[model samples]
Target chain A: DVKVTQSSRYLVKRTGEKVFLECVQDMDHENMFWYRQDPGLGLRLIYFSYDVKMKEKGDIPEGYSVSREKKERFSLILESASTNQTSMYLCASSSSGAGWGEQYFGPGTRLTVT
Target chain B: ELKVEQNPLFLSMQEGKNYTIYCNYSTTSDRLYWYRQDPGKSLESLFVLLSNGAVKQEGRLMASLDTKARLSTLHITAAVHDLSATYFCAGLMEYGNKLVFGAGTILRVKS
Candidate 1:
Protein backbone atom coordinates (compact mmCIF):
# COMPACT_ATOMS: atom_id res chain seq x y z
CA ASP A 1 0.00 0.00 0.00
CA VAL A 2 1.20 3.49 -0.83
CA LYS A 3 1.19 5.93 2.07
CA VAL A 4 1.82 9.63 2.31
CA THR A 5 1.45 11.30 5.69
CA GLN A 6 1.30 14.93 6.66
CA SER A 7 2.03 16.65 9.92
CA SER A 8 -1.37 18.17 10.53
CA ARG A 9 -4.84 17.79 9.13
CA TYR A 10 -5.93 21.22 10.37
CA LEU A 11 -3.84 24.17 11.40
CA VAL A 12 -4.38 27.76 12.41
CA LYS A 13 -1.69 30.40 12.25
CA ARG A 14 -1.46 34.07 13.09
CA THR A 15 -0.34 36.67 10.64
CA GLY A 16 3.41 37.10 10.22
CA GLU A 17 3.96 33.69 11.77
CA LYS A 18 6.26 31.15 10.28
CA VAL A 19 4.56 27.86 9.53
CA PHE A 20 5.87 24.46 8.66
CA LEU A 21 3.96 21.61 7.08
CA GLU A 22 5.72 18.31 7.05
CA CYS A 23 5.15 15.34 4.76
CA VAL A 24 6.55 11.86 4.65
CA GLN A 25 6.10 9.01 2.22
CA ASP A 26 6.94 5.35 2.54
CA MET A 27 6.84 4.51 -1.17
CA ASP A 28 10.49 5.34 -1.88
CA HIS A 29 9.45 7.85 -4.46
CA GLU A 30 11.98 10.24 -5.97
CA ASN A 31 9.71 13.16 -6.55
CA MET A 32 7.66 15.06 -3.95
CA PHE A 33 5.45 18.04 -4.59
CA TRP A 34 3.38 20.53 -2.62
CA TYR A 35 0.16 21.98 -3.92
CA ARG A 36 -2.40 24.44 -2.61
CA GLN A 37 -6.06 23.84 -3.44
CA ASP A 38 -8.35 26.83 -3.65
CA PRO A 39 -12.03 26.91 -4.51
CA GLY A 40 -11.92 28.14 -8.11
CA LEU A 41 -8.24 27.96 -8.98
CA GLY A 42 -7.99 24.23 -8.49
CA LEU A 43 -4.70 22.82 -7.23
CA ARG A 44 -1.69 25.04 -7.86
CA LEU A 45 1.79 23.77 -7.39
CA ILE A 46 3.83 25.62 -4.81
CA TYR A 47 7.13 23.74 -4.80
CA PHE A 48 8.65 20.38 -5.59
CA SER A 49 11.77 18.45 -4.73
CA TYR A 50 13.35 15.78 -6.86
CA ASP A 51 16.26 14.89 -4.69
CA VAL A 52 17.71 15.59 -1.28
CA LYS A 53 18.35 19.33 -0.89
CA MET A 54 17.15 20.03 -4.42
CA LYS A 55 14.08 22.22 -4.98
CA GLU A 56 12.24 23.97 -7.77
CA LYS A 57 9.65 26.71 -7.74
CA GLY A 58 6.27 25.95 -9.22
CA ASP A 59 3.52 28.15 -10.64
CA ILE A 60 2.58 29.69 -7.27
CA PRO A 61 5.71 29.63 -5.15
CA GLU A 62 5.75 33.27 -4.20
CA GLY A 63 5.07 32.84 -0.48
CA TYR A 64 6.21 29.25 -0.06
CA SER A 65 9.43 27.28 0.22
CA VAL A 66 10.23 23.62 0.58
CA SER A 67 12.96 21.46 2.12
CA ARG A 68 13.96 17.92 1.33
CA GLU A 69 16.67 16.81 3.71
CA LYS A 70 15.84 13.12 3.79
CA LYS A 71 14.67 10.74 1.09
CA GLU A 72 11.22 10.17 2.58
CA ARG A 73 10.54 13.54 4.16
CA PHE A 74 9.54 16.80 2.52
CA SER A 75 8.61 19.99 4.31
CA LEU A 76 6.78 23.10 3.16
CA ILE A 77 7.44 26.41 4.84
CA LEU A 78 5.45 29.60 4.88
CA GLU A 79 7.87 32.35 5.79
CA SER A 80 5.09 34.63 6.96
CA ALA A 81 1.60 33.33 7.00
CA SER A 82 -1.20 35.52 5.69
CA THR A 83 -4.94 35.13 5.34
CA ASN A 84 -4.56 34.78 1.60
CA GLN A 85 -2.42 31.72 2.19
CA THR A 86 -5.29 29.93 3.85
CA SER A 87 -5.96 26.88 1.71
CA MET A 88 -5.80 23.13 1.70
CA TYR A 89 -2.20 22.01 1.38
CA LEU A 90 -1.52 18.68 -0.25
CA CYS A 91 1.63 16.61 -0.49
CA ALA A 92 2.21 14.10 -3.23
CA SER A 93 4.95 11.64 -4.12
CA SER A 94 5.71 9.97 -7.40
CA SER A 95 8.39 8.02 -9.18
CA SER A 96 10.69 9.83 -11.61
CA GLY A 97 11.57 6.80 -13.61
CA ALA A 98 11.19 6.29 -17.34
CA GLY A 99 7.44 6.08 -17.40
CA TRP A 100 5.50 8.66 -15.44
CA GLY A 101 3.48 7.29 -12.59
CA GLU A 102 0.42 8.55 -10.81
CA GLN A 103 1.15 10.66 -7.75
CA TYR A 104 0.02 9.45 -4.37
CA PHE A 105 -1.44 12.30 -2.32
CA GLY A 106 -1.49 12.83 1.39
CA PRO A 107 -4.59 13.52 3.42
CA GLY A 108 -3.84 17.27 3.19
CA THR A 109 -3.62 20.02 5.77
CA ARG A 110 -6.27 22.72 5.89
CA LEU A 111 -4.58 25.88 7.14
CA THR A 112 -6.37 28.99 8.24
CA VAL A 113 -4.45 32.21 8.69
CA THR A 114 -5.82 34.81 10.99
CA GLU B 1 2.84 27.14 -20.34
CA LEU B 2 0.03 24.61 -20.48
CA LYS B 3 -3.54 25.22 -19.43
CA VAL B 4 -6.28 22.70 -18.76
CA GLU B 5 -9.97 23.57 -18.69
CA GLN B 6 -13.08 21.65 -17.74
CA ASN B 7 -16.70 22.49 -18.51
CA PRO B 8 -19.95 22.23 -16.59
CA LEU B 9 -18.14 22.80 -13.35
CA PHE B 10 -21.21 21.62 -11.47
CA LEU B 11 -23.42 18.76 -12.57
CA SER B 12 -26.46 17.26 -10.88
CA MET B 13 -28.07 14.06 -12.11
CA GLN B 14 -30.34 11.34 -10.86
CA GLU B 15 -29.06 7.90 -10.17
CA GLY B 16 -28.60 5.57 -13.17
CA LYS B 17 -28.06 8.49 -15.48
CA ASN B 18 -25.02 8.90 -17.68
CA TYR B 19 -22.79 11.95 -18.07
CA THR B 20 -19.45 12.94 -19.47
CA ILE B 21 -16.84 15.42 -18.25
CA TYR B 22 -14.57 17.02 -20.78
CA CYS B 23 -11.02 18.25 -20.40
CA ASN B 24 -9.21 20.40 -22.92
CA TYR B 25 -5.58 21.39 -22.93
CA SER B 26 -3.94 24.36 -24.55
CA THR B 27 -0.64 22.76 -25.48
CA THR B 28 0.50 19.29 -26.46
CA SER B 29 0.35 16.66 -23.76
CA ASP B 30 1.27 13.03 -24.02
CA ARG B 31 -0.02 11.82 -20.69
CA LEU B 32 -3.39 12.55 -19.11
CA TYR B 33 -4.77 11.61 -15.72
CA TRP B 34 -8.12 11.57 -14.01
CA TYR B 35 -8.63 11.88 -10.29
CA ARG B 36 -11.57 11.72 -7.92
CA GLN B 37 -11.72 13.75 -4.72
CA ASP B 38 -14.40 13.30 -2.16
CA PRO B 39 -15.41 16.09 0.19
CA GLY B 40 -12.91 16.66 2.99
CA LYS B 41 -10.61 14.02 1.51
CA SER B 42 -7.61 13.67 -0.74
CA LEU B 43 -7.51 12.75 -4.40
CA GLU B 44 -7.65 9.22 -5.77
CA SER B 45 -6.24 8.44 -9.18
CA LEU B 46 -8.89 6.90 -11.38
CA PHE B 47 -7.30 6.60 -14.78
CA VAL B 48 -4.21 7.37 -16.83
CA LEU B 49 -4.37 7.71 -20.57
CA LEU B 50 -0.98 7.63 -22.24
CA SER B 51 -1.70 7.54 -25.93
CA ASN B 52 -4.04 8.70 -28.61
CA GLY B 53 -7.32 6.85 -28.96
CA ALA B 54 -6.69 5.16 -25.68
CA VAL B 55 -9.62 4.02 -23.61
CA LYS B 56 -9.74 2.54 -20.15
CA GLN B 57 -12.62 1.55 -17.91
CA GLU B 58 -13.05 0.72 -14.28
CA GLY B 59 -16.42 -0.36 -13.01
CA ARG B 60 -18.75 2.51 -13.98
CA LEU B 61 -16.19 5.11 -15.06
CA MET B 62 -14.51 5.17 -18.45
CA ALA B 63 -11.81 7.55 -19.71
CA SER B 64 -10.46 8.28 -23.15
CA LEU B 65 -7.72 10.42 -24.60
CA ASP B 66 -7.22 12.02 -28.01
CA THR B 67 -3.73 13.41 -28.48
CA LYS B 68 -4.49 15.04 -31.81
CA ALA B 69 -7.31 17.01 -30.25
CA ARG B 70 -5.52 17.53 -26.98
CA LEU B 71 -8.64 16.46 -25.17
CA SER B 72 -9.74 13.85 -22.65
CA THR B 73 -13.13 12.68 -21.53
CA LEU B 74 -14.40 10.90 -18.46
CA HIS B 75 -17.67 9.15 -19.07
CA ILE B 76 -19.78 7.96 -16.21
CA THR B 77 -22.17 5.06 -16.73
CA ALA B 78 -25.05 4.39 -14.38
CA ALA B 79 -24.19 7.01 -11.81
CA VAL B 80 -24.55 6.02 -8.18
CA HIS B 81 -24.62 8.08 -5.01
CA ASP B 82 -21.26 6.64 -4.06
CA LEU B 83 -19.84 8.09 -7.28
CA SER B 84 -20.70 11.62 -6.25
CA ALA B 85 -17.45 13.49 -6.00
CA THR B 86 -15.25 16.08 -7.66
CA TYR B 87 -13.36 14.89 -10.74
CA PHE B 88 -10.19 16.47 -12.05
CA CYS B 89 -8.23 15.95 -15.25
CA ALA B 90 -4.61 16.91 -15.63
CA GLY B 91 -2.13 17.11 -18.46
CA LEU B 92 1.52 16.37 -18.07
CA MET B 93 3.68 19.40 -18.56
CA GLU B 94 6.05 19.28 -21.50
CA TYR B 95 9.38 19.77 -19.78
CA GLY B 96 8.97 18.53 -16.27
CA ASN B 97 7.17 16.08 -14.03
CA LYS B 98 4.47 18.60 -13.24
CA LEU B 99 0.85 18.50 -14.30
CA VAL B 100 -1.56 21.25 -15.35
CA PHE B 101 -4.95 20.44 -13.92
CA GLY B 102 -8.41 21.47 -15.00
CA ALA B 103 -10.68 23.37 -12.61
CA GLY B 104 -12.50 20.14 -11.79
CA THR B 105 -16.11 19.05 -12.18
CA ILE B 106 -18.35 18.55 -9.21
CA LEU B 107 -20.90 15.78 -9.79
CA ARG B 108 -23.87 15.23 -7.57
CA VAL B 109 -25.76 12.00 -8.01
CA LYS B 110 -29.18 12.06 -6.45
CA SER B 111 -31.44 9.14 -5.74
Candidate 2:
Protein backbone atom coordinates (compact mmCIF):
# COMPACT_ATOMS: atom_id res chain seq x y z
CA ASP A 1 0.00 0.00 0.00
CA VAL A 2 1.09 3.55 -0.68
CA LYS A 3 0.97 5.04 2.78
CA VAL A 4 0.80 8.79 3.05
CA THR A 5 0.75 10.21 6.55
CA GLN A 6 0.27 13.72 7.86
CA SER A 7 1.67 15.16 11.07
CA SER A 8 -1.65 16.20 12.56
CA ARG A 9 -5.22 15.27 11.91
CA TYR A 10 -6.61 18.46 13.43
CA LEU A 11 -5.01 21.78 14.28
CA VAL A 12 -6.15 25.10 15.64
CA LYS A 13 -4.11 28.25 15.28
CA ARG A 14 -4.61 31.92 16.03
CA THR A 15 -4.84 34.36 13.22
CA GLY A 16 -1.49 35.65 11.92
CA GLU A 17 0.29 32.70 13.44
CA LYS A 18 2.63 30.59 11.40
CA VAL A 19 1.43 27.11 10.64
CA PHE A 20 3.27 24.10 9.30
CA LEU A 21 1.72 20.89 8.03
CA GLU A 22 4.00 17.95 7.48
CA CYS A 23 3.48 14.97 5.20
CA VAL A 24 5.45 11.81 4.65
CA GLN A 25 5.03 9.12 2.05
CA ASP A 26 6.44 5.61 2.32
CA MET A 27 6.29 4.63 -1.33
CA ASP A 28 9.32 6.63 -2.46
CA HIS A 29 7.26 8.54 -4.98
CA GLU A 30 8.99 11.43 -6.67
CA ASN A 31 6.08 13.83 -6.61
CA MET A 32 4.24 15.37 -3.67
CA PHE A 33 1.36 17.80 -3.58
CA TRP A 34 -0.60 19.91 -1.09
CA TYR A 35 -4.25 20.78 -1.58
CA ARG A 36 -6.95 22.56 0.36
CA GLN A 37 -10.59 21.45 0.20
CA ASP A 38 -13.49 23.82 0.71
CA PRO A 39 -17.24 23.26 0.71
CA GLY A 40 -18.27 24.00 -2.87
CA LEU A 41 -14.92 24.68 -4.52
CA GLY A 42 -13.67 21.13 -4.29
CA LEU A 43 -9.93 20.53 -3.95
CA ARG A 44 -7.50 23.16 -5.18
CA LEU A 45 -3.82 22.58 -5.45
CA ILE A 46 -1.69 24.79 -3.25
CA TYR A 47 1.80 23.60 -4.07
CA PHE A 48 3.63 20.67 -5.53
CA SER A 49 7.15 19.30 -5.34
CA TYR A 50 8.62 17.30 -8.16
CA ASP A 51 11.98 16.57 -6.63
CA VAL A 52 13.85 17.28 -3.46
CA LYS A 53 14.30 21.02 -2.98
CA MET A 54 12.19 21.67 -6.08
CA LYS A 55 8.82 23.36 -5.73
CA GLU A 56 6.13 24.81 -7.94
CA LYS A 57 3.08 26.93 -7.20
CA GLY A 58 -0.40 25.75 -7.99
CA ASP A 59 -3.60 27.71 -8.49
CA ILE A 60 -3.98 29.10 -4.95
CA PRO A 61 -0.40 29.55 -3.79
CA GLU A 62 -0.49 33.15 -2.65
CA GLY A 63 -0.81 32.64 1.11
CA TYR A 64 0.92 29.27 1.19
CA SER A 65 4.40 27.91 0.50
CA VAL A 66 5.93 24.47 0.50
CA SER A 67 9.21 22.72 1.22
CA ARG A 68 10.72 19.46 0.09
CA GLU A 69 14.09 19.01 1.69
CA LYS A 70 13.78 15.23 1.63
CA LYS A 71 12.37 12.82 -0.85
CA GLU A 72 9.81 11.28 1.48
CA ARG A 73 8.76 14.45 3.27
CA PHE A 74 6.95 17.58 2.17
CA SER A 75 5.80 20.48 4.27
CA LEU A 76 3.24 23.24 3.74
CA ILE A 77 3.79 26.58 5.42
CA LEU A 78 1.29 29.31 6.01
CA GLU A 79 3.07 32.58 6.65
CA SER A 80 0.18 34.31 8.37
CA ALA A 81 -2.78 32.10 8.92
CA SER A 82 -6.17 33.66 8.46
CA THR A 83 -9.71 32.48 9.05
CA ASN A 84 -10.12 31.97 5.34
CA GLN A 85 -7.18 29.62 5.38
CA THR A 86 -8.99 27.23 7.64
CA SER A 87 -9.73 24.19 5.52
CA MET A 88 -8.97 20.53 5.18
CA TYR A 89 -5.41 20.02 3.99
CA LEU A 90 -4.56 16.98 1.96
CA CYS A 91 -1.19 15.54 1.03
CA ALA A 92 -0.70 13.31 -1.96
CA SER A 93 2.21 11.46 -3.53
CA SER A 94 2.57 9.89 -6.92
CA SER A 95 5.20 7.87 -8.68
CA SER A 96 6.85 9.18 -11.81
CA GLY A 97 6.66 5.82 -13.54
CA ALA A 98 3.84 4.45 -15.63
CA GLY A 99 1.35 5.47 -12.99
CA TRP A 100 0.78 8.63 -15.06
CA GLY A 101 0.40 10.92 -12.09
CA GLU A 102 -2.08 8.88 -10.13
CA GLN A 103 -2.17 10.60 -6.75
CA TYR A 104 -2.54 8.74 -3.47
CA PHE A 105 -3.76 10.96 -0.67
CA GLY A 106 -3.31 11.05 3.07
CA PRO A 107 -6.08 11.21 5.63
CA GLY A 108 -5.98 15.05 5.57
CA THR A 109 -5.50 17.66 8.31
CA ARG A 110 -8.37 19.88 9.30
CA LEU A 111 -6.89 23.23 10.19
CA THR A 112 -8.96 25.82 12.00
CA VAL A 113 -7.54 29.33 12.02
CA THR A 114 -9.27 31.34 14.68
CA GLU B 1 -6.74 28.52 -19.44
CA LEU B 2 -7.77 24.96 -18.78
CA LYS B 3 -11.18 24.59 -17.23
CA VAL B 4 -13.02 21.53 -15.99
CA GLU B 5 -16.71 21.59 -15.30
CA GLN B 6 -18.99 19.02 -13.72
CA ASN B 7 -22.75 19.02 -13.93
CA PRO B 8 -25.22 18.45 -11.07
CA LEU B 9 -22.80 19.31 -8.32
CA PHE B 10 -25.10 17.44 -5.96
CA LEU B 11 -26.79 14.09 -6.46
CA SER B 12 -29.23 12.10 -4.38
CA MET B 13 -29.95 8.50 -5.26
CA GLN B 14 -31.92 5.69 -3.74
CA GLU B 15 -30.54 2.21 -3.38
CA GLY B 16 -30.69 0.18 -6.61
CA LYS B 17 -31.06 3.32 -8.71
CA ASN B 18 -28.53 4.35 -11.34
CA TYR B 19 -27.18 7.68 -12.49
CA THR B 20 -24.26 9.31 -14.25
CA ILE B 21 -22.11 12.32 -13.41
CA TYR B 22 -20.77 14.41 -16.26
CA CYS B 23 -17.40 16.11 -16.55
CA ASN B 24 -16.36 18.43 -19.35
CA TYR B 25 -13.16 20.26 -20.08
CA SER B 26 -12.42 23.35 -22.12
CA THR B 27 -9.02 22.52 -23.56
CA THR B 28 -7.87 19.34 -25.16
CA SER B 29 -6.76 16.66 -22.75
CA ASP B 30 -5.72 13.07 -23.28
CA ARG B 31 -6.07 12.01 -19.70
CA LEU B 32 -8.88 12.23 -17.18
CA TYR B 33 -9.12 11.07 -13.57
CA TRP B 34 -11.82 10.27 -11.06
CA TYR B 35 -11.48 10.41 -7.31
CA ARG B 36 -13.72 9.75 -4.31
CA GLN B 37 -13.52 11.55 -1.02
CA ASP B 38 -15.53 10.59 2.02
CA PRO B 39 -16.69 13.06 4.63
CA GLY B 40 -13.71 14.55 6.48
CA LYS B 41 -11.44 12.12 4.62
CA SER B 42 -8.96 12.55 1.83
CA LEU B 43 -9.47 11.53 -1.79
CA GLU B 44 -9.01 8.07 -3.21
CA SER B 45 -8.16 7.56 -6.87
CA LEU B 46 -11.02 5.73 -8.52
CA PHE B 47 -10.14 5.52 -12.20
CA VAL B 48 -7.70 6.93 -14.71
CA LEU B 49 -8.87 7.39 -18.27
CA LEU B 50 -5.84 7.75 -20.48
CA SER B 51 -7.38 7.82 -23.93
CA ASN B 52 -10.48 8.47 -25.92
CA GLY B 53 -13.24 5.91 -25.53
CA ALA B 54 -11.46 4.53 -22.50
CA VAL B 55 -13.57 2.95 -19.80
CA LYS B 56 -12.68 1.48 -16.44
CA GLN B 57 -14.85 -0.04 -13.77
CA GLU B 58 -14.48 -1.03 -10.18
CA GLY B 59 -17.24 -2.33 -7.97
CA ARG B 60 -20.42 -0.48 -8.91
CA LEU B 61 -18.69 2.60 -10.31
CA MET B 62 -17.54 2.96 -13.89
CA ALA B 63 -15.77 5.85 -15.61
CA SER B 64 -15.41 6.65 -19.31
CA LEU B 65 -13.58 9.32 -21.20
CA ASP B 66 -14.08 10.77 -24.69
CA THR B 67 -11.18 12.86 -25.86
CA LYS B 68 -12.98 14.09 -28.94
CA ALA B 69 -15.78 15.57 -26.94
CA ARG B 70 -13.52 16.54 -24.04
CA LEU B 71 -15.90 14.77 -21.72
CA SER B 72 -15.91 12.05 -19.11
CA THR B 73 -18.70 10.27 -17.30
CA LEU B 74 -18.86 8.35 -14.07
CA HIS B 75 -21.76 5.94 -14.07
CA ILE B 76 -23.12 4.37 -10.95
CA THR B 77 -24.98 1.07 -11.20
CA ALA B 78 -27.30 -0.17 -8.48
CA ALA B 79 -26.23 2.59 -6.10
CA VAL B 80 -25.69 1.80 -2.45
CA HIS B 81 -25.02 3.78 0.71
CA ASP B 82 -21.35 2.88 0.52
CA LEU B 83 -21.13 4.74 -2.79
CA SER B 84 -21.93 8.05 -1.17
CA ALA B 85 -19.05 10.45 -1.47
CA THR B 86 -17.79 13.54 -3.23
CA TYR B 87 -16.60 12.60 -6.70
CA PHE B 88 -14.11 14.78 -8.52
CA CYS B 89 -12.95 14.67 -12.14
CA ALA B 90 -9.68 16.20 -13.22
CA GLY B 91 -8.19 16.75 -16.65
CA LEU B 92 -4.51 16.84 -17.44
CA MET B 93 -3.65 19.98 -19.29
CA GLU B 94 -1.24 20.46 -22.15
CA TYR B 95 1.98 20.61 -20.16
CA GLY B 96 0.71 17.65 -18.14
CA ASN B 97 2.23 19.02 -14.94
CA LYS B 98 -0.99 20.26 -13.36
CA LEU B 99 -4.52 18.90 -13.16
CA VAL B 100 -7.66 21.00 -13.34
CA PHE B 101 -10.43 19.58 -11.18
CA GLY B 102 -14.17 20.09 -11.43
CA ALA B 103 -16.36 21.48 -8.66
CA GLY B 104 -17.18 17.91 -7.69
CA THR B 105 -20.43 16.00 -7.35
CA ILE B 106 -21.60 15.14 -3.87
CA LEU B 107 -23.43 11.82 -4.02
CA ARG B 108 -25.87 10.94 -1.29
CA VAL B 109 -27.16 7.41 -1.51
CA LYS B 110 -30.29 6.80 0.51
CA SER B 111 -31.66 3.57 1.83
Poorly placed runs, candidate 2 (over 4 Å): none
lDDT of 1 by residue, A1-114 (tens): 879999999999999999999999998889999999999889999999888899999989998888999999999999999999999999999888855657889999999999
Worst 10 residues of 1 chain B by lDDT: B92-101
> Which one wins on TM-score?
1
Clashing pairs in 1: none
lDDT of 2 by residue, B57-109 (tens): 99999999988888899999999999999999998777755678899999999
TM-score of chain B taken alone, candidate 2: 0.98
Measured against the native two-chain assembly using Cα atoms, what DockQ does each of the candidate structures obtain, in the order listed?
Answer: 0.77, 0.72
Q: Count the backbone clashes (under 3 Å) in each candidate.
A: 0, 0
In candidate 1, how many Å is residue B66 off? 0.9
